[model samples]
Structure formats: C-alpha cells, structure tokens
Target: MTLWRLEWLRLVRTRRLVAILGAYLFFGLTGPLTARYLDRILGGIGTEGVRVQLPAPTPADGIAQFTGNASQIGLLVVVLVAASALAFDARREMAVFLRTRVRGAAAVILPAYLVSAAAAVSALTLGTLAAWYETAVLLGGLPVARLLVGLACGALFLAFAVAVTALAAAITRGVAATAGAALAALLALAVADGLTGVPWLPTRLAGAMETLVRGEPATGLPAGAALTAALTAGALAAAVAVSDRREL
Candidate 1:
C-alpha cells in the first residue's frame, strides 16, 4: 500500500497524466458526436461540386464511429502514454534507490501495476460515460444491457493496453525504445488482424465493442479475454525475471 501510494503520487504529479486524460476526454466526447454529424460535415466540405447523398445516421453508425475512433487513435494514445510512464522512470534511474532499499520486486512491480490500472480505469470510465451520453442524445434510447456490455469490452481493451505497455517497458531500458517497441507490437497485431482475419487476438478486442452494443453475443470476447489474461501473466513474469537479473 505504501509503495503503491508513492508511485501513485509520482504519477499524479506528472504532466503526462493530465495531458493524456485531457486529450482522451476530448476524443471520447467528440467521437460519437462527430459521427452523428458526419453527413453535415461532409456536405459542408463542398468538394468540387460533388454532391454525395449520405443516409441518415443511426444508433449503430454512432457506435461504429465511437468504436473506430476509440479503438484506433484512442488506444494508440493510451499505449504511448502508459509506455512513457515506466519507460521514462527506467531511463532516468528513478527507481534505483527504491529498488536497492526495498529489496523486493513487489515494491516496484506492485506500484507500477497499480498506477497503470488506475489510469486505465479512469480513462475507460470517462470514455464509457461520454460514449453513452452521446449515443443517448444523438441516437435516442439505447439498451442498458448493450451499454454495460460495451463498457465491459472497453475495460478489457484498456487492460490489454496496460499489459502491452508494461511488457514493452520491462523489456527495454530506454524510453524511446520502449515506446517504439510497444507501438510496433500494437501496430503489428492490428495489421495481423487485418491480414489474417483473426478477431480473437488481444489487439483486436476493441473491434468487438460494436457487437456488444448490438446485444449480440460477442464471439471474440471470451477468446480475447483469455488472450489478455495470458499476455498479462507473461508480462508480469517477464518483468519479475528481468528485475531479478538486474543490478538495480
């Protein structure tokens, strides 16, 4: 608890948290709203007098836009921000003194995990609320079950992001290298999903959000959840193993 508090305080004091949260909030609030007004925006573009007739946007359209924006751009931002947190600390040797004095991997691992989890929870909660409100206002009434399922999917997606970022940070001692590796890993998974047609991978979990929102049984949800759990375990084990071999 004490170590977690210390790490939490460090995270709170960093500008990265504020900046990332602010940007995410903006996107979360605007994603569905923008989707609702897509026709208007496109028509206003007035490209070469080409009149494009767009159909009226539906609830599913709004959800699709929200999921697209959140899963792609939003998740990328999350990975970068989370990777920077620990990567920066490692690069600056910020944990050296603590590592030497604490004499246990738990002191470092627990706090880092707690901080990452807290950030994920906050972002997921805010994004879910914004998505729900936007859907309600723009698309009229939405089912509570669908909303809950979407939220669950979002939470799981955030967990996958945290796990990936932590593993990247643990593997690389430099901030830039860690961030690059994490982003590359994420991008690779996305590319693989596109190429291989596997929706059950950890990286493609966010793509299942729409299914949940439609009250459909999400086929990829359980498989993605299992993948995330396995990845998280692997990341933690790798971190502990690496920490044990390090000189601190």
Candidate 2:
C-alpha cells in the first residue's frame, strides 16, 4: 500500500497526465453537445441555393456522437499519455531503481499497475460524468442502465489500453518507440474495423454503447470484452517477465 501510494503520487506530479485528463474532458463535454446541434450546424451551411434536410436528433444520436468521439480522439489521447507512464520510467532507469529497492517483481509491477489503473479510472469517470450531463441536457433524462453500460465499456477499453502501453514499454527502450507502437496498434485496429466485419474487433467495442442504450444484447460486445481481458492479462505477464529479467 505504501509503495502504491508513492507511485500514485509520482504519476500525479507529471504534467502529461493532467494534459490527458483535460483533453478527455474537453471531448467528453463536446461530444453530446455537438451531436445535438449537428443538424443545425450542417443546415447553416448555405451556398449556391443548395439545402440539406436532416431529421431531428434523438438521444441515441447524442450517445452515438459521444461514443464516436470518445472512441476516436479520446482513445488516442489516452494512448499517448499512458505510453510515457510505462516507457519513460523504464527508459530513465526508474523502473530498475525501484525494482532494486523494492526487491520483488510483484512490489514493482503491482504499484505501476495500480497507478495506471487509478489514472485511467479517474479520467474515464470524469469523461463519463461530462457525457452524461451533456446527454441529459441535450436529449432529456438518460436511463441509469445506459450510463452503467457506458461506464463498463469505458473501463474495459481502458484496461486494454493500459495493458498494451505496458507491453510497449517492456518491449521498447525509448519513449518515442513506445508511443509509436501504441499508436500503430490503435490505428491497425481502426483500419481492421473499417475494412472487415469482424464482430470482436477492438474498434467496434467503443460503439457498443448503442446496444446498451437500446436495451438489446450486442453479439460482438461480450466477445470483444473477453478477448480484451485475455490480451490485457497476456501483456501484463509479458511486462512482468521483462522486468524480472532486467538488472538495475
């Protein structure tokens, strides 16, 4: 517990973490608000006597916007922020020092994992609250179940992100390489989602909010969640193995 508290404080003192939270908050507040007024914003564009008619927005529309932005831009920001959390410490030999002092693999790994999880949770919770408030105001009151669904999805996605970032840090020695690797993984998933109809793809997991709000079971969501959990566990194991092999 003492070790975990120290790690948490170290992470909190970093400027990058604060920037990540700010960026996510901005996107979260804007997602639903932008969706609600999207039609009006598009309609305002008038040129050469051309007009486009859009149907009135619904609660689902707002949620869709929130999901889309959160999944796209929000995920990118998180990846960048978390990449350094894992890689930077390792690159600077901080991980090695901590491991030497702590004198156990679990002591070092557990604290790092706790810090990452705490940061991810804090950012996601704030973003969720921002989305909920914006959505409720734009499209009346939202259901509690739908909110829970979103929260769950966010947590699952963040777990996947943390795992991948840790893996990148373990595999690479430089922060730049780690960041690039993490971003590339995210891009590949996005590309696969755009090109293939695979149900369990990571990119599609973000959009699962639709099924939750509609009170319908999403066939792919559960599978995606399971796969994500497996992958996360694998990454954590690999990171631990690598840390164990390194000498301070």
Candidate 3:
C-alpha cells in the first residue's frame, strides 16, 4: 500500500494522470461527434453544389470510430506515457534505492502499472459513456451490455500495453528506445492478428472490440483474453527480474 500510494503520488506530480485523462475524454467525445457530423462537414468541403452520397451514419459507425481512436491513438498514448515510468527513474539512482529494499520487482512494477491502468480505464469508461450518449442521441441507441464487453476487452489491451512499456523501460535507458521497443512489440501483435486469425492470441482482443460491439460472441476472445492476461503477467515478471539485474 505504501509503494502503491507513492506511485500514485508520482503520477499526480508528474501530471501524467491529468494529461492522459484529458486526452481520453477528448478522443471519446470526438468519436461520436465526428460520426454524427462527418457528412455535413465533408459535404461543405467538397465542390459547391456537388452532392455527395454518403451512407447514413449509425450507432455502429460511431462506436467503430471510437474503437479505432482508442486502439490506434489511445494505444500509442499508453505506451508513450508509461514508457517513462521507469526510464526516468533509472538515471536517478532508484536502482540502488530499490536494491536496498525488501520488495521485489512486482512490488515496484505493479503499482506503477495499476496507477496508469486505472487512469486509462477510468478515462476510457467515461469517454465511451459520453460517446454512447452522443450516438444514442444522434445516431441510435447501442446495445449497452455488448458495448461494455467491448470496453472491457479494449481495457485489457491497454493494461498489456502498460506492462510492455514497463518491461521496455526496464531494459532500456532512453525514453525513445523504450517507447520504440514497446510499440514494436504491439505492432508485431497487430501484424500477427491481421496475417493469421489465431484463436488463442491476445491480439484478438485488441481487434475484438468492434466484434463485441456488433453483438457477436467473440469465439476466440475467451481464449485470447486468457492469453493476454498471461502475457501481461509475464511482462511484469520479466521487468522485475530484469530491473533486479541492473547495476545500481
């Protein structure tokens, strides 16, 4: 509890918590609003009096936009922001301080991760609800239960991302390198998902948000979620082990 509280303070002092939450809220609002007005906005941009025939936007369209924003930009934000959690401390002689302590890597890593995850999940939840409200008012009402499932799946991906960033920061000294390593790993997962439709891979959850929103039982997601959880745990464990090996 002490360590977790300390990490939370760090997040607050660093202003990362505020920034992440603000960005998530902005993106969330943008998703449905854009979906609702995209045609009107685009039509005004095109040649004057040249009517553009666009398919009617629906709740699905708004949700799809939200999913895309969260998966792409939101995923990147999680990696970039969390990448510095450990990297910045590496140069501060924290390694020596931690080495003298009784707590192992999990003790240190979990708090940082949970703080970031909590902020991310909270923002995502708030944002998604805002989007849902907008879509319900502008486009149409969405299936609440299924939307929640999709949000849960998306949050898992984010949790994995925070773990990966921690692992990268543990291995690398530079922020850019840490971010690169984490993003590269995510890209590999995405590529694997696109190239091969494996049922057991966690990447399925990343892409499964839309499927869940569509009310389709993600046949692969159950196994994929289990896989993602294992991988996140593995990443945190590896980070602890690696950080322990670092010279103070």
- Best by the TM-score measure: 3
Clashing pairs in 2: none
lDDT of 2 by residue, 165-213 (tens): 7777777777778878877887787788888878787656667775577
lDDT, candidate 2, at 33 = 85
Residue range 48-147, candidate 1, lDDT tens digits: 7887677877666666777777776777767766776656446545667566667676567756765876676677668767777887788765677766
Q: Which residue pairs come into collision in candidate 3?
A: none
Cα RMSD for candidate 1?
2.2
Error of 1 at 204 (Å): 2.8
What's the residue-level lDDT of 66 in candidate 1?
70
- Which run of 10 residues does model 1 get worst, by summed lDDT? 84-93
Best by lDDT: 3
Q: Which stretches of candidate 2 lie over 4 Å from their true place?
A: 45-48, 88-90, 104-106, 214-216
Query: What lDDT score is found at residue 212 in candidate 2?
Result: 74
| Runs off by more than 4 Å, candidate 3 | none
Which should have the higher TM-score, number 2 or number 3? 3
The number of clashing residue pairs in model 1 is: 0
lDDT of each: 0.70, 0.72, 0.79
